[model samples]
Target: MPEQKAADATPRRLPPGGGHRGGGWMNAGMPAERSMNFGPSARRLLGRLRPQRLHLVAVITLAVVSVALSVIGPKILGHATDIIFTGVIGRQLPAGSTAEQAVEGARAAGNDNFADMLARMDVVPGTGIDVAALARVLLLALALFLVASLLLWWQGWLLTGVVQRTVRRLRADVEDKINRLPLPYFDRQPRGELLSRVTNDIDNISQTLQQTLSQLLTSLLTVLGVVVMMFVISPLLAWVALVAVPLSVVVTQQIAKRSQRQFIAQWTHTGELNAQIEEAFTGHELVKVFGRQREVEAAFHAKNEELFRASYGAQFISGIIMPAMMFIGNLSYVVIAVVGGLRVASGTMSLGDVQAFIQYSRQFTQPLTQVAAMANLLQSGVASAERVFAVLDADEQTPDPAEPARVTRPRGRVAFEHVSFRYAPDTPLIEDLSLVAEPGHTVAIVGPTGAGKTTLVNLIMRFYELDAGRITLDGVDVTTLRRDDLRGRVGMVLQDTWLFNGTIRENIAYGRPDATEEEIMAATRATFVDRFVRSLPDGYDTVIDAEGSNVSAGEKQLITIARAFLAEPSLLILDEATSSVDTRTEVLLQRAMAALRSDRTSFVIAHRLSTIRDADLILMMEQGRIVEQGSHRDLLAARGAYHRLYQAQFSQPVADDATLEPASVAT
Candidate 1:
């Protein structure tokens, strides 16, 4: 269903109070406090690339050559300029005289090699113009340019595959980590924020690998190569250019340091914004019903504004690198020009040599400016990588015991022996709780909100480890069994129905992927889902949208019931499974549940007293302990909490075997 249409179609009968206001979206995946170690995080990130060491070496080699060509091209062009200058100056000599005569006349006392002496002569045909030599030099420069371009392309092509493979492995590791995480981890995190880590943060790392890595390498290489070339041309001009290097470094470091916090803040705020949007849209029904549209909008606007401020601050601070470096570079250039002009006038350095030194000086400063500009980008990429690594570094759930036991065909006898648990260390919710349910018995757990009804079920399923004692299933300690084996034998139909985007048949058969079509049809028919399935045009093939929004809440609940039924587990848990259905559907559902629970051990957590009045054992809980426990008649005779609860829910004592049905009660 389109989001707009679904938002507009509010349920005709919303529960008296809105259902859970804080849902999957309310939790931001990231922590509020920001802390990171840039050096360690960068090292760890680079370590992931170790598998691509060969590819990295090749890329670095190519980058060095590319930068070397760029540095050499300018010096060669300067040589051409020198040749033209000498040709013009030599015009004062005889028409065919070359600069070789002047070099020979000014020969030093040291012996010169034959090749060196030959190179001193201009090989061009004319004395005033070396057209052929200039053309040859230009042609060499063009060839270098073309070769560098090809090397750059080849480097990029190789690195792209390597980077993609690395990211792919990282993404897979993250996915595996998520699966191994304890339920409490998810409880403490926001769904959207976690999603941001998996997507936004990882994507940022990919982009940095694709673009920034090559550029950064090339820039650093260019800077080093240019510095060396500058010194060769004229150490005086080289020193002048080096003066700007430290200044640029100081400027870049200062600005980047200031921008780091903003970059972290920007990403953090982005996570908050994504979480808010996810929550608002997921619970749009509650917002519309309670007229909380303005409140949601205001909350979103606040987060968006915070993100905007952080993003702007990060950009503005990092942006200072380029212009500041350029200004310093330009100042150094002017200094070199003044010094080199005096040397040329005094004939200590020829005009051609001075011109070549100027070219080398420009090349020296260009890469410094580029490096400054890239500092911010590299910092941001590191921040993103740090977040991705955090997920990989998270503590995982305890592994199953060595030589774990497997339940072949569970008899469903469960015993909670002196079990103690609490969500937090300071707040004890369940203490020394003991309970037993034999095979084929119905154990009804009824309690007020926060009275540990769901906690009891969670313990039985081993979704959490007990603080002090053991929970046993069929006389086997649950802790000794693999979690997958333990949960596989226990089926649950929760209050909140969850159905992914798929055909109705797929949703119903989720619990047993290899279930035959006949079994699926039979389970759906038993749960009364077949009645509604036939009404739809596509029947079992109809697609259910995300959250099963295309279907009504009651329909969604029934489908989940069918899923549990199809699994045919030895133990069944219905945690307000009938809460969403209408009174009529609930009655039929109860009948179906009765048949489904006939031979299996069942735990029913509900607020409606009528539904559980006939349970084999009823546990009326207050806080974390069971205050009352007995058969319905025995409990009423005691006139205790269960009796009081039953009296409050009905007009009179319910003695009828079949006529004591009541609607869903808010817990």
Candidate 2:
């Protein structure tokens, strides 16, 4: 019925230990941690990059070219070292001595092992260091490195654009999806939880892509290139260096497996904590009025503690990956160093070849280490992605008709034919009830809480689809008509007044954006908003805060009424529209509404029976059925359900000839 009034009239308290489920107060639609599907979620996240495939390909190409250049530099430096070593050995021998003479001289001098080492070297006894060749090789290596660095920079630039564009598209999709979702979807989801998905989770996804995409690509390619180069120099050393690969894999898999659950839990707790904070702040005054500040603080602390535990566990477990990988890499390095040194001493492998192989071994392990380090970010990103994807994948409201019916001249003749609806399968809120509001009639629905008053108006607006019968507006089924078209013809003023962060003038003109200043002022005067506006320093330009806390509740209600008046719609729905206003202001509002409702059908759902006494038709509802329907006078004369309600409400007997006027009721 009057949803806001019903909710505010009765508040439900959480039972003791109620919110500790799954380690936090889980939202209705939130998936359980154990149910998270990492693989499918990750794949779907990757699919968002499909639109940026061309840019990704270019990034991959740049990475490959740059890494190839980087991998070849070490071998070139080794060759330069060989040239210097040869020249240094030549300088130690006698001038003009031949290579054979040097070896024999070394053997004759009781250095036979040295002679053997010299035999393997391309040393000239008479020559000095080849400075020219060394310079050329070093310069070549420098040039290659410089080019590789430039390519990497360009790749990073391209990758950044790709990531930002992808995130932008994702944000647009989420916005569109929210607009398409049914009202019940929001009823199930907490505002803060949804905000977390839209803002925080999306931001996390962006950061993860920026950090991991380029680095992961370069690391993978570097590993491959380095492995090939290592084999080219010495297959034996290559095999020895690869001994760490399997071990690194094991460590990463084990840590990631454990850390992934923690990451999911961390984000889940984050959302829950956000919801609690939003609720506490929004209702801070109420909490104080009820002396529940301590309880609120206690709930906040519990949620915050859950978040801390989840975050600490995730970080602690994932942090072990890098150190473990480094240890494995170091072990491989030691083995490669000893084997390469032994090969060099035996003269089977040149010193330069061993040097190049050692460099290659380090290069191979470095990328492996980088990959291990990124495991934490990858896991966290996937967890956030799953949350976002869940929203994207939720069931949307039924689509509007393909060929919508139009009311060229709407007379606001709304009729419900055997309409039935239920929020749940077992609990019927409205059933097989029918009613009609003729053109230019003011229909007032009066009832206690949960009497289907607001629900009837909601049905005419097509907020919820009927389970059986259909509602028609001007002989056209509301479902067949486009929602925008139907709503455009109707103006609504809810008990809960909503004003955006804007000027008073702007808020009043929200429904009629193209209305002139003269028209806006007229509306404000009609609804008594102009009376207060003239007293404010800024007058019509006075700004309202996001929560409209800057204005009094009565003034806020007046502004909303003025907004509805400005629309000049074919039909009007006022659900406790004057509930917030004082008696004087409400009397003024009644006059304004009388003027606005002229020649237009109006539906007014009110608990204050005095406001609707003059309504042409009054429907008294109870338990989803209309117990009585007639003019206020006729219903009182019958002394039935409506008479009993009136007597109970006023708590007094009234003379049959006396009229119950607004002014008298206010007194």
Candidate 3:
């Protein structure tokens, strides 16, 4: 089997956001990574509310009261129906009965009054209006309705504050989790997919809590409240309404279960599409240079089409719930009406009772329809919650030692003693590797592609833990010291330059936030960054965009060099740091690096043989092992693997006179 470098050294296969589809967005398609469990995720999400339990209790209480007020209004209206019927029948009022007393007596008679009906009944000789009783009941109903609306509003207002706080904490947790995660996590996962979990997923949870959460509580109470009222009116009719419950459950469960998988697919495809878009846009210029625009568009179209299919399936399937529920509810309604009419006619129930029963039945089925309708959204919220929790629960980097050794001033002496590591457990990339670099020495690493040159640098920096190895700095084990302290003493400038949106001064001072203005200028001048910054309109204050697109790639590299200079590290690692600059700038950067490396140990990994020809030591690696180690002159004299590589990089091919094919360089 072919050898592979350490995991971090391997090229990332997925774009920044191109997450794996299995186990939804949370798992990111890694078989070793764990997907979130819904039950645990939900419990953790609700646990966030523990701090605001009192507020949540108040919100629930208010929701229940609001529904209760709305539920009882119909019953009160039924009483008024009886009053109007009695008044229209010309019932006479007793002598000396005041309007208020007559109204009370009318209510006591168990049949309520309507003000308009009572006024019209005055024309009959044996009848008189009972306006006071009708007005009292109507006013009470109106008051209850108004008060219930107020309660609903208040509950929503309180919930808004609570949900906002919950979302704030969630966002904070994700931000912190990003820092705790291992570098390997980001290598396999896209920044965009992780961002989707942090921003989009958390936002989804917030929306559900703000809007759907309150409605969920109200719908549940309405269903319960309506059920009790149904039984109270007539158990026979109640049984008929209850028939819709199981049927609704069966239909909703079947549809929701199918759509749930589709919902997961929809989000997974969404993450994939986002990752693709992010990669395409990030390297749009590369796409144009390589003439792969059509290919990119085709890939995007395929992912988009998949997204469309998943979205349509989830939505179309879930959409069936509302209408199916409505049909079931209507069927229950007809049965109740027919059966109830027979019972009323047979003196088993009153007209008012039947009227109340019909209203309660409508109330019962309405919430069922609502819950069924929101089934998709609820599942989406749960899925989002699961993804968010996955990040929170992901394994963090190895913790620092309990009693870490303090490095007061790291001396640059470094050593690797029988170090062995692999990208995967079974694939050995490095075995029994050993090397030593004394203080203030320049140790250059030279190797072909896939020779684990960068992997050696990663191991030295401890970006990845070794499978079996002991690396030491100044005779002290590097792992025994706190990572922050160990890393603070080392500085690196890589081929890929990273600069955030900020002023030139801010970007340079990023590693040393408290550096003084004079100190910054000194470092900038040392790295020749001051030469360019002086030409810019804002000098060092020029604001760069997120990608630093305003500056050329070489300029970005110069700025990163200046950043490392300001860091004043004891050990420096340059991984083809001058690959982007022109020959003139490269010469200047070499002089600056020589000056920087005078007192500090430096490790240079370069393909350009001329760059490392003057180094104190040179190590030639092949297939994850150091095949040759010596000074440039000694390697040149030995004529081994390093000699062949140096000759390939520097030697030109002879022209062939006989054949049409170009002559090949001698090995």
The C-alpha stretches of model 2 lying farther than 4 A from their native spots are 1-32, 104-116, 652-667
For residues 13-69, could you state the per-residue lDDT of candidate 2 as single tens digits?
Answer: 322222222222333223435536778888889899999999999999999999999
Query: Which sections of candidate 3 miss by over 4 Å?
Result: 1-44, 91-129, 343-348, 655-667
> Which one wins on TM-score?
2
Per-residue lDDT of model 3, residues 1-667, tens digit only: 0112322243434432343321122323322122355467667777887888899999999999999998888787766655565565445555555555555555677545333233323223235445777788788889998999999999999999999998998898889888778766765666556667787888888986776778789999989888887888799899989998999999998898788777777776666666677777877898899998887888778777877987899889999999999999999999999998777555476656788888888899888888888887877777778778778888888888999997666679999999998765666778999999999999998877767788888887777788888999988898898888888889989878889999999999999999999999999999989999899998998999999999999999999999999999999999889998999999988999999999989999888888998899999887688999999999999987787777666666446423211111121
Give the true-structure RMSD of model 2: 4.5
Compare the candidates by lDDT and give the number of the best one: 2
Local distance difference test scores for all models: 0.79, 0.83, 0.79
Q: What's the best-to-worst order under lDDT?
A: 2, 3, 1
In Å, residue 60's CA in model 3 sits off its true spot by: 1.5
Question: On a 0 to 100 scale, what is the lDDT of residue 479 in model 2?
Answer: 92
Clashing pairs in 3: 16-190, 83-112
lDDT of 1 by residue, 1-667 (tens): 1111112112222111111122223232223446487788778877899999999999999988887887888778877877777677556444554556544533553334422433443543245767898899989989998898999888889889888999999899999999898866665555666787899999988887777777777877878898888888788778888988888888888898899888887877776676678778877898899998887777677667778888999889999999998899899989999998876655566656677677777777777887777777777778888778777888898898989987666789999999998767777878999999999999999866667788788888777778998999998999999888888999999887889999999998898999999999899999999999999999999999987878999999999999999999899998889989999989998999999999999999888877887799999887788888999999989987776667657756456534332311224
Q: Indicate the residue-level lDDT of 303 in model 3.
A: 76
Cα lDDT for residue 76, candidate 1? 82
- Preferred candidate (TM-score higher): 2 or 3: 2
For model 3, what is the C-alpha lDDT against the true structure? Answer: 0.79
